[model samples]
Target: MPKRDWITRLSTKFRQCQQSPFWHGAVALLLFYLPQTAGADLIAEGRAIVAEHCTRCHVVPEINPKGGIESTPSFKGMKHLADWRRRFEVFFTLPPHPALVTVVGISEERDKSRPAFVQEIKLSVDDLDRILAYVDTVKN
Candidate 1:
């Protein structure tokens, strides 16, 4: 609540860390190493998500070997495009995607009767970021 209380809590934590030293290492590991894992975890999550959902119509060579409809471009090829980043960023709003993809909190739910579409993927903003982060690694 107050500045004094905050300092007191911090000092208490410092004392606790001093007493165990394990806390010091734990904090260091989290501060230094966890950040690297964050990007890796995001990419892993994106890979899994794409494998589960995107592989339906899109070819994601980073995660899948052989799949995707011929009409759709492979992520590998698309990565070299000038607007690839922008394309993935707002992909949920584009063309056939609108019928099959839904970005949580971003895109509205579509009617089930979207004609030829059978399934729609629901993705969060975080998922989109994850996908972008993974896509960023593509060789283009």
Candidate 2:
């Protein structure tokens, strides 16, 4: 469909729906429950992905406190930092993390001078989004 036509049709339907009792109830139920379910699912999947890839290096507090280097910061600890959101948003572009984590499409070339003793992690842009979403919910 043409972009303008599609948008017009959508707006027209939305306007029609706005006047319906069923619409209000449905929208209310969705507004009340959807975020809880969707956000929880995103966080849960992010946690699983982090457990599979990130726990190898970063701490996840109770989930994997002793899993990685003792000096490494936990997810909650990182979450508390002032630039935590920006840092996590572009973590794959940062030093050390880039060496360990590879974003499927954006990662650059790496040194192969020495044989890798540990496996390199692979993540998609979607996975990165999930990680940040999960990290956002982490508490001190």
Candidate 3:
């Protein structure tokens, strides 16, 4: 608890850390850098997926100018909604969407009631996460 005791303890711990085979400095660097790197990767992958799949029906900024379908909303516009993330999470599981993409045992059942242009596209949960990550970067 004394000043001298605290200093001695700190120095001893530093020495132990330096002597160990484990590189604490490298671990610290990784801890600091990996998340941002992973996030950037996710955003990039998400952007690619959106460009490939959603651009057909939705307006994607920096990728597409006009919405593929007049009725469907633009990705840039959706980013402004308060519940965007939740809406996106379930967007593919809802009514008109049940006709699109089969996932996790969910089968694609094309809705004859909907337009013929609504095509089924398979997407995994990981894909959804990546898409959301990219969507998060969109400005309001």
Candidate 4:
């Protein structure tokens, strides 16, 4: 069949299904379940991103050995803080972060307690979103 005819047939079938009670229930179930699946996938992606970037300095769930420095808080621990979500939202723009990336280089007045060997790390907004989603799953 021609492409146009194939699409028209499919559309007609879909419209027919839309009028059926069975299809309505199926649609409702799909609508209810899809977001949960998407959320799970997003959390999984976030975990992977944390493992790739933050694991060097922060312990992340399910990544083994409880990595990161002793002084630096684990991802699970940080999640327990009331303001952690807000802090994480702006984490990349925070002080010492820009310096860590050599955006301006560390100033003498900067916090002296930070690890000297901490490397510059950069993440896309999507990556940050995923990491936050994963962090949300971490229990206190």
Top candidate by lDDT: 1
Per residue, candidate 2 scores C-alpha lDDT tens digits across 48-100 of: 89888888778887578678877777787887789999999998887777667
- Report residue 53 deviation for candidate 4 (angstroms): 0.7
Instruction: Residues 1-140, candidate 3: write the lDDT tens digits.
Output: 56798899999999998877687778888999999999999999999988988888889878888557889888888988889999888887766666665555444554567633456677787888898999898776
lDDT of 1 at 57: 80
Off by over 4 Å in 1: 1-30, 112-116
In model 2, the runs with Cα more than 4 Å from the true position are 1-23, 109-117
> Over the stretch 1-140, how does candidate 4's per-residue lDDT look in tens digits?
46798899999999998899998899999999999999999999988877777777677666845567787777778778899899877666676455553212322333667643466565566777897898888776
Pairwise lDDT winner, candidates 1 and 3: 1
| 1 against 2, candidate with superior lDDT | 1
Every candidate's lDDT: 0.83, 0.82, 0.81, 0.73
Query: For each candidate, C-alpha RMSD in Å?
Result: 6.2, 7.7, 7.8, 6.8
Model 1 residue 15 CA deviation in Å? 9.6
Listed per model in order, the count of residue pairs whose N, CA or C atoms clash below 3 Å is 0, 0, 0, 0
What tens digits encode model 1's per-residue C-alpha lDDT throughout 7-44?
99999988887889787788898999888899899988
> Considering summed lDDT, which 10 consecutive residues are worst modelled in model 4?
101-110
TM-score of 4: 0.69
Error in Å for residue 6 of model 2: 32
Candidate 4 at 6: error in angstroms? 17
* Worst window of 10 by summed lDDT in candidate 2: 109-118
